[model samples]
Target: MALDETTRQVNKRAVAALEAAVWGLREADVSVIKAVQPLEDLSNVTNAHDPALEELNALTVRIRAAREEVRRRWIAESEGER
Candidate 1:
């Protein structure tokens, strides 16, 4: 079936949004791996109040914030929202 121009535009946007979502997930995965490397280096934290642990917590917050925005934007685009 031939799609109308509007439908074709929407399909393009959706494909881009889905690709963004996939990239966002991959970025999050890499962030987790990089953040966890410090734990292995520090031997699972020298103490409960370790600096590496603190840094990891910060990175988690940052990654979560970024990923959430990507997810929201992708959902909005998929739903035909500008």
Candidate 2:
């Protein structure tokens, strides 16, 4: 069966968030491994540096939330069908 508009939108957002999290991790890896000067320049110097690392952390949170939302909605839908 086809998903409703709201469900479809939630699923789309979840997928997008997952993709973004993956890309963010890759970017972080490259930033650390390649020692990209420009990317490094964007980081603050005060101990808590690394903008890519920060971005990856934020993306990880977003991905978890999105996946949980998708799972919760899917479970609700499945229960409703029974």
Per-residue alpha-carbon lDDT of model 2 for 1-82, expressed as tens digits?
Answer: 3568788676666656656655665565555445545445556555355766566556556656665655555555545541
Residue-wise lDDT of candidate 1 within 1-82, one digit each (tens)?
Answer: 4568878787787869676776877687687878777675776546654766667777777777777777777777666676
**Per-model TM against the reference:** 0.54, 0.40
- C-alpha RMSD in Å of predicted model 2 compared with the true structure: 8.4
Clashing pairs for model 2 are none
Q: In model 1, what are the clashing residue pairs, if there are any?
A: none
- Overall local distance difference test of candidate 2: 0.57
Indicate which candidate wins on TM-score. Answer: 1
Total residue pair clashes for candidate 1: 0
- State residue 18's C-alpha deviation in candidate 1, in Å: 5.4
Candidate 2 segments exceeding 4 Å error: 1-49
**Top model by lDDT, which number?**
1
Which runs in model 1 stand beyond 4 Å of their true positions? 1-18, 21-23, 26-45
